[model samples]
Target: MRFSLTCLGRKKPRLLASEILKNVEALKTPAKPLRSQEAEFIQAPDLSVNPFFQQLPPTLANFFKKYPPAPFRKYADKPVATNAEDANPFLPNKNPVTGRYAAPKYSLRRQSDLYKAAYRFGIAHLLPKLGNNKKFYEDKHLNKTPVRGSVMFKLTKGERTKDSRIQEVNEALSKADEIIAEHRGRAYRRKLERKSQQTTPWF
Candidate 1:
């Protein structure tokens, strides 16, 4: 399966790097220090037993399509009591991970094992979701075209302004100032050119 990761935003690159580091750290059991330039591939198996896998969004759906459902027994319709002392009505004997129970019910250690298994499975299942953001950029040449004004420009001028006269005055003044600035710049440039022409050339 192809896997990739895409990150955007001011700090997203750093966050992505840290996440990668964490995943690499999980490989420490093999007694190897992860190098930054190592190959960008990891082997992960789907050990997920959570029934909630089917309910995940499309971004996660692609990852789970490869793995089989986790092995878990469904919870019974009703709690089976061995004795009045053995069963607590509110504290029903059941597996928290599967929301189900076996004959004698799973002990704390068994339940913890199940949880760890679920966790390993969960990480494997989510790898694809993390990698779904990859993309490729295509470059192309396009013909230049005159850009049309926005639809808002079709509205009557007075429709937007409270007083057209005031707006006209402001616009005229703005244009006048622009023209004045241009004239001043041209005058300064001509003065410099004239000064340069008047300079006596030294042999």
Candidate 2:
């Protein structure tokens, strides 16, 4: 009975692990240190190349790749295709590296959105029935945002009159003038010092 090559290989005796260790120990060369700390780094001789293997001149080196000779060139008479014919244009493309056919990806939500968009193009104006665009407000006021919930600033109780605004400005200017006069007055300063001294103890 003829045994298969793999069966014969399996039947063969494997070398003992102890014998391998004994043979390795017989060598005169010292065993390499187990720890990296004990091991000294030695530069490989192959890394330092010979002078003969120095970089060849550009003349000797190939500038462009040579075209590989085709063994079968019997189709030379056949007309070269100008416009390539597609086998299946609708089919999903394959990934070259993975060698797996790619699945066609589609967004259902985007499709639904597109379907929804098809119904509406723009605002449709009914010219004949379009009523007069008469604007109606409870009161005529510019600062509507403040009265509304989106309050950027507080609204005044009543509208300010031109005379009242001018009067307020004049009052403010008079107050400023009075403050300047008080600052320049030596008598006012003396009065202030006496008041402060009376309010607080000397200690």
Candidate 3:
């Protein structure tokens, strides 16, 4: 369930493979809407306060550039590293059913919203093609038990050195980008298992 990748020197421990896996798994699922009337909806966060795109690895960042997350002009600006929690795409909109709405939640433990935007963007890509048919959105994308998974990317239980954290994000993003590109926006463990076993740093 977990793997460790120490830096070349072994003196500086890089991020753990398990931690990187957690981030990648989180982005696969869309955030669930609050069904409770009291469930608060999040507001559109200022890119300054919580950036979603800028912090992403280059592959994903460029993809969003080619396909903007929103038509808003603010999206054009470079987003800085968010303290996790920025990955949720639902923040800008309130649940039509649950009137209660609020702003995005932040945590030092969560990964930014960057990778998730990719999957939802794929959902967006599928949307226009469907025209009025909203079945995918209603049944799959928004479904609580999405056939996919969550976009959480929870932080490790303990504090990690800055470099380890960065590496974790980088590896997760890289793995995620490949999944998005190859599967037409879906990832499953079985398919990943089919990949040629490769190691980083060429140990």
Candidate 4:
């Protein structure tokens, strides 16, 4: 009697063995390396020659090239109007119907005062303390102290206008600049000390 082996109910004849061997050989062969298949890497684009920078005006483009975005400074020198009433005219006006006071409106005088104040104080931030009260404004001794908001609100508006607002703003700006400069100097000194510590030989 003769016998033949079968797989999945199909008989494989002896003549098909060569084809099966060829398939197994193909599977055994190694694939090409991944590095060989990839393209070479290229360098990043140059930002200085970018099309966007080329389109800007010369002064603005130069500014962008030289400095970072934050903490930009612009300076202006002009005579400040010392007269409080002339500078802040709106302080005098009262609402006739309700008898409540309104802050200075946008008259030419007020605008001039606003410009002067902005220049004196720097445009970024306002002075923290400001006001006019009988205790602060009227009393000669108390006027030396900082004005409180609640007391300032109760006083007649005219008293506030009499005080030299421009001078007050100038004083505030001077104080702020002094404090900023001191802090910055301290920070820079600390940085230098740290650098020295890193480089110096330990005994």
- All candidates: TM-score: 0.15, 0.16, 0.16, 0.16
Q: Please give the CA lDDT of all the candidate structures.
A: 0.45, 0.38, 0.45, 0.46
**Candidate 3, poorest ten consecutive residues by summed lDDT:** 125-134
lDDT of 3 by residue, 48-125 (tens): 333654565565565444434444323212222232222332232233456444343322112123333445645243
Model 3 segments more than 4 A misplaced: 1-50, 72-138, 141-203
lDDT of 4 by residue, 46-144 (tens): 446677656654544443444322334221122123232222232334455666555533444434443344334343122111123112213447456
Model 1 alpha-carbon drift over 4 Å, by segment: 1-73, 81-103, 123-203
Q: Which sections of candidate 4 miss by over 4 Å?
A: 1-41, 67-152, 156-203
Model 1, span 34-91: residue lDDT tens: 6644532353433343356655544344423532233321222245443433242222
Error of 3 at 176 (Å): 72
Better of 1 and 3 by TM-score: 3
* Candidate 1, residue 11: lDDT: 42
Best lDDT goes to which candidate?
A: 4
The Cα error of candidate 2 at residue 128, in Å, is: 38
Give the Å error, residue 122, model 1.
1.5
